[model samples]
Target: MTAETLTVVDTGRDKKREQGQAELVAAAVEAARPGLDKIPDPVEPDGDGDLTAEEKERLDTCIGGVELLSTAFWIAGKSLDTMAKGHLIRRIPHKLEPERYYETIEEWAWLEYGIKRSRCAQLRAAWALGEVLAARGYHAPEGQVRELVPLKRKYGLNAGVAMYEIAVEQHGADKVTAQRLRDLVKLLPEDLALKDNDDADQIARMFGGVLEHAEPKALSAGGAIPTDVRRGVDRRALDLANVLNRRRIPRTEVERHLLEAFADEEDTTVFDAVLARMKENKGK
Candidate 1:
């Protein structure tokens, strides 16, 4: 009331701040609204989707009521680390777990926005790719999103996105359709299919011509990876890393209790060596 009664003047700073806030909110909404289908069945939310104290404040204030849910978004820092966690932190209010407030995303979306579950899924997917689609004026959106779903399912989300970018580069955006994207992902070597985010990124840049091809002596050295090439060392490292991302077997369980996690005793020595090397690398 006091602010309304008083006239305020700005020296452009206010406008810039407001614009920044608006952009953050828009990006947050997109990140948070991942497809309903993407949610796990048992729904193992990251760290059980625990809301930080800051997140709790936003739920109460930003989404003050059902009326605000559709239009409002909470601010979360948009870093690469945070991006992977976009769906995890943003949508906890909708999971149907008792401790988590016993609401389903389907019902929650319906109650807040009057949108169907399927429509929510599509909107979630589209918004997720907003940046990518924005480049082409979002031409042929339906066809684009349609293919993205399958690509995401086959290779994890990051890999799918890499493939999409590669597809756009190889085949112009105007011609890049659902079928075209499908054929591109299929063409990826089997060894490359399950790539982690970094590997996917390098491949995307290499294929998309963003990465300069370094070939003075051998022109073709900068291009194409064939199916038969062995990825023995790198692939094994990635597989091991993925396993380690989950629960690591306790040393006490393996050494003291003599668990069969490793069939051979020599493998235990190898694990110790790998851990030492990892620690050494981290320091550097």
Candidate 2:
């Protein structure tokens, strides 16, 4: 296939569809919000049993932002009216709390093998973060604009953490950066993955792992396989030795001694290729 064709194939149509849904949901919520204070019955009702294939189907018509807001508004026990509340309760699990809502949503969406409510929930989270950031006098970084456009094309307005991570990378992290992130997260819709500061910190630690492994110097340092892959390689080496051994090399000790072979080029080819060449009069 030509390059152009390949690009088209690689394009994430699912993400684009998600983003489009978010835009629509955003419009609906905005319209709904202004009338909220005037409405008497603000709580949407809950769906008691399993959603039918049709109700499950309508859930797809909703996007991430809508699900999130619906979750929040539902949990808050506020809806535009009894009619609206009935509509929501009939549509989604009314019994489940916002935190547990994703589980049910994921199941239904996955069952259909089409656009899922879980994706919309993620997008809504991203959108809330953006809203919080904008409220704090921030904007997407200049270079990130191009990248975000594609992500937005794929993921929608809800690509919050990733978008912020890019911004932080480009702009540099400090008190302001951290503050903005914390602030934005505070505005997340109900049923967001984060429960507390620890949750946020866990995510940060995960990102730290990414950065630590992403260093160019580390990548270029022989482009060695990762620790897990190294374990597999070492196992292979021991199996090779079991073949060579008058007494086979012990498989149990393979992980420990693989490092030793790595140190010398001569022993290295089988176990430590780097160490194997260091040996004198060795031919393989």
Candidate 3:
């Protein structure tokens, strides 16, 4: 075919795909409504029971959420009620005839909404973090929202929000980014994944001491922290090895010798406490 004909053919294919996708979206919403309406009266983890008034209210929320999603995926980007959407999307399955509708939200997301489970999850996290940040008066864009997601996942949504506030307060939201957030989260004690402690100031203070010893360059973004904890543990282990070398002790013998010395004690709690104290006082 001529180049002009080829271009027209490709354009036709694009139009066809677009039409099909639009139909798919409409169909998904159409399909979900009946199932949502039929939601067996109750929508708990197990679907055999009936729904309470409170449960019915929540079920409406889920149904309303899908409607909102159909019209405005960008509802996720909006500050108003964005988290409610995220929370619902994260739990769209809602035990609504699991065996009939589909076993998991991921399956429903794929077959019904035509959205990948990964994108579904990302929207859920990003919306949650974004709303939390918005509550703190920062309508963080997707970039910053994306950064805060890891913080939310690692700690809690409050922790993520707290971290965003800290970052914006430190560097202004425009200047801050995913990389900047990652840097901040990394400096947080390697073990700073506290779910219950969402206090921003308290969390901000967590890595404060690490700064005293960490070089300025050390704070520069290393791009990203590995999602796998083992990678971090491995790096920390290597650093510990270097620290051990400074003390001129063999790695294996240190623990072995400690056991030998503490052989008389059935419980090593006393030694563990001492070692913990020594770690706490390392700089001093």
Candidate 4:
């Protein structure tokens, strides 16, 4: 046989081998993935119409099954990380351009489930947090760690990490249950002002009364401000209150200061000024 013919045959064989390997990998992933019998059919009416009886039944069944499965997984101490990763790996190959599978598991989940990518990511993070806590010897109750996932997002990753470390060190893994962890996270110093104090328990109790009274009211649907924006405001207000309490500023005085500040300026400028003042005072 000619050298040219031999070279062409070798290249063809290599291509076939690569294709076979890809197919095998895809099949293995698919086989390992959770069965889809648990997921409900996604078909529904296109517009502002109600679902048909069949659709409604399917939807209800799906939701119920999902809730049951979720609770079961949580109770069984199964990590959502495993589920999320397996789902992405299994489904990515089915896409027309599988090369884009590396984008993000959350994005892939959105494509597959039609849920918001951010929500999917939050659940994934919760599960991952559970794994992290477990590995750190802090074995919280089955679903306890997951409950802190939203707080993790709210407080920021660095804050969450610091809280976990501090909780483990101060309270010990056994003592840091879900509720205790929540309380501990709430007691985290908003800024660097009070971090020098090692008494998390004392700090939590000191601010607990103020925090209880400062709970944000439910936002009305017709309100101009978005829920997230309102939550941000509430968080800032809480932070300010913490700083004030740390400085031993009386509640009535803090209220008077806010009234004066708002009377002068109605915008976020007032908030910024107050926070700056509080931080400055804390410095002294």
Candidate 5:
């Protein structure tokens, strides 16, 4: 046949495969819904020697539905990962308006695939990370790439990107292995994951002094300080108090200083007392 004829034949095959896949996905969803609906009801045998007809039917339906739903969900997750990888590698977004593809992907994920935007974002980030890995001569397996995306998303996008960069820099591109990347990802502080620098900084400042003391005490004593032990102070306050006392400042002294500093301010007594209580609990 001619080149044009061959092209037409290839297109037909592609369309047929696409149609078949769509049908299968629809069938899976349809099958899963019935199972999901029955999940709330308990599937128990009747007190009699045998289960009633309705109970028997419900048990069979619920079990089969759950199994089908589980399999369908697994398949759907794999398919999404594959689609995300293809979209990233092919630079599909560039075919349309620049950056429009990100929004388009979110919309398509929600409308067509019933996935949320956050999940789509995870897939996108995973694909981008996978590309980076491939370029560095570390081709991560498909499952590994998918697994890394959720960890990256936990830190938010900017932080995730920053982590990837940091990992590459700390562990030379050539030396960076999948396990090394996983370890580096885990090292990221939860506070650092906040997208806003101001928020992250504020948290660090608030908990910084307390964390230093609390961590050691918890380690040495082998227990965490329970919150709600004091009227105004929580576990965090207790931690801060412990740290201050470790520096040789007495709880009473700290309380006196705070009370004097806030004497002019109204409703400062509660705050002062909490600090004093924290100091009292220090070292114990």
Candidate 6:
């Protein structure tokens, strides 16, 4: 066999050493089952007829059902993808695009699990799958899979890179670096454009920061650092670094005031501060 083929064989051996073949197959099988969208759609709002208490409750319950199923499928799909890649590795390569796979898997799990409105079933299933993978020595990747959603739109879903595209348009690399900021502050598309140059001017005043296009860094101390934050926020930051590159924030500054805002120590404080500052400056 060629060197490359030898490498594959060696790597395959390494994977087996890392996690046994039997375990991987088991994970793949479990991940594939319980396909998406098993529940019926919610009832239409009462438009022509008088509403009955039972009818209203049923409709409400169904609406909740949709929400729960969607969330569970999402969780299950994420967990399965991770497990598949970690376990199966070369076998049963996932031909389906990442995002498409996610949607499809979610639908499958929703139907298969018969999850209730509480979404307890889906969460349980995902958690159980995660536990199984963990027991087999599998771990999910740190960052999310990008564009696995899709580059273009289809089936009424937006492009996978839509968020990045919007971030690029609005803040450019700033979007990539400060992804956590954008999400935490809940900045809108309109905010993409500087609502006012004055805010930019203020940021310049405080931190010597200006929005510029450049590669971002994996993690930087240029912004306020927090000792603690939700696992979700940290994950977003890591994702920002992974997707945008670590050098995205080439020349930003952190303000003491921003750090002080963490006085409440909410952990999400950095986001709160940045958001508050942005809004405060926007009004000016």
Index of the highest-lDDT prediction: 3
lDDT per residue for candidate 4 within 1-284, as digits (tens), equals 99999999999999999999999999999855555764665664655788778677878777666645544444332333565556636535535576555356555555665547666555556654555555555555445665566555664333444456555666676677667667654443333233434353444444454443432222232257566754555466567868767533333344455566666754767878778988999999
TM-score of 3: 0.42
lDDT of each: 0.49, 0.44, 0.60, 0.56, 0.53, 0.41
Once fitted onto the true fold, the runs of candidate 5 whose alpha carbons sit more than 4 angstroms away are: 1-125, 131-144, 191-193, 196-284
Q: Tell me how far the alpha carbon of residue 121 in candidate 5 is from the true structure, in angstroms, after superposition.
A: 11
Candidate order by lDDT, decreasing, is: 3, 4, 5, 1, 2, 6
Cα lDDT over the full model 4: 0.56
How much is the lDDT of residue 280 in candidate 2? 42
Residues 78-138, model 5: lDDT tens digits = 4667766566434445334457454355655776557798776655456555555455455
Would you estimate the TM-scores of all the predictions? 0.34, 0.24, 0.42, 0.32, 0.28, 0.22
Better of 4 and 6 by lDDT: 4
Stretches > 4 Å off in candidate 4: 1-122, 154-158, 168-171, 189-284
Q: In model 5, where is the ten-residue run with the lowest total lDDT?
A: 213-222
Worst 10 residues of 1 by lDDT: 213-222
Give the true-structure RMSD of model 1: 22.1
Which 10 successive residues of model 4 have the least lDDT summed?
213-222
Give residue 144's error in model 5 in angstroms.
5.9
Clashes of each: 0, 27, 1, 0, 0, 21
Runs in model 1 lying further than 4 Å from the true structure: 1-102, 111-114, 132-140, 189-194, 199-201, 205-284
